[model samples]
Target: MRLFIAIELPDGLKRAFAGLRTPIPGARWVPPEQIHLTLAFLGEVEETAVGHLHDELSRIRIPSFKLRPAGTGCFPGRQRARVLWVGLEPEPHLRDLAAAVQSVLLACGIPQEERPFSPHITLARLKLPAPREVGLFLSGEPKHAFPLVPVREFILFQSRLSSAGAQHVPLHSFPLT
Candidate 1:
């Protein structure tokens, strides 16, 4: 199955992000339901590996912690941006949880990710024919600062790619306790 681990955002935050979806042209906005901060992307794992992954993840114990979305930015350089995201505030618990997840995935014989973990909420994915007006829109975008919310659980999500956008379904949930 096509799977990944992530922390889902509450509706309030989702709506807040959805509000900013406009103005940026040629960018595919993420559906509110699929707005989540991914911890790891485990592409196309075997059905049998699911059980092993679950068992390993079940041992990860992290206390609930607050996360606040900070400034906006684009990945892979601003000029050649592929993804736009809201940066995350530095939270110790978040780092710990990420490290623990990485360790668990490694113990399950999953290949280590070469890129360092940088937490952020993906807002949109840009297409090649990005609108010329995008530079002005993104430049004048207003700042956003919202109340921090506690994340109590992380989920394993299955992604089914279709002609439209991808559909994310929560396959399993691991609580932070």
Candidate 2:
């Protein structure tokens, strides 16, 4: 099964992002329901391993923290961009939560990512759209400063790729105290 661990966004934020998607011409916007801040992407794992992964997740202890979506940015240096995302503030607690989740994946024999983690909620994937337009859109600041919201849970999601886009299913959820 294809899986990953992430922090789901609240409904209001999802709606806000959805509104942004309506106008973008060629970019493939992820379904609002699938919008999440992925901490780690565990590409494929044996179905049987899910149980053990859940156990490791259950043992994770992290205190809830507020998350503020600060800015807009793109990945791969924006020269040949692939992903458009909303940048997150450097919240120590959020980083700690991500680290805890990473530890669980490592303990489960999952390979660790060598790249340093940069927390962001992917808004869209650049495909047919002119990358230049994305730069123009990002040239101006976002109208609002989404206030910090408390994050209390991390979810294990299964990604199903389709013609439309990737559909995510929640396999399990673990609460942070």
Candidate 3:
């Protein structure tokens, strides 16, 4: 199965994120329910391996923490803006949580990501750079767009790919104290 780990957002925040959508020519906004802060993306795993993955994930004991949207930016740089995203206010606890999850994945024989963890919620998939729309969107959004989002749990999600795009289904949830 194609799987990953991430923090789900609250309904109000999802609605607020949806409200940020604009009519940019080559951009597709992420659906409200699909928005999440990804911790690790595990491309594929054997059915038998899932049990071990879930067991390792449950062993994580990070405390819950609050985070908020700080601003917006593009992936692979703005000059080649392929993804538009809302940056999260960095929390050490959040980073530690991600690290713990990664450690578990590595222990389970999952390949490790060479890149460092940079937390952000993807807002749209962009086919081309929409600089004008991006600037307007940034200026319109307050420095801190949403209220503090309490992240009490992270889930191991199964991603089913289809013509309609990817749909995430929670396979198991790991709670934070």
- Judging by lDDT, tell me the better candidate of 1 and 2: 1
Candidate 3 residue lDDT tens string, 7-38: 99999998988888878888988989999999
Clashing pairs in 1: none
Predicted candidate 1 versus true structure: per-residue lDDT over 9-100, tens digit per residue: 99999998887775555788898888899999988888899999999998999999999887777777667777877778899999999999
Query: How would you order the candidates by TM-score, starting with the best?
Result: 3, 1, 2
Candidate 2 — which pairs collide? Answer: none
Model 3 weakest lDDT span, ten residues long: 136-145
Error of 2 at 34 (Å): 1.1
Give model 2's TM-score versus the native structure.
0.91
Q: Scored by CA lDDT, what does every candidate get?
A: 0.84, 0.83, 0.89
Poorly placed runs, candidate 1 (over 4 Å): 129-142
RMSD (Cα, Å) of model 2: 1.8
Estimate candidate 1's alpha-carbon lDDT, on a 0 to 1 scale.
0.84
lDDT of 3: 0.89
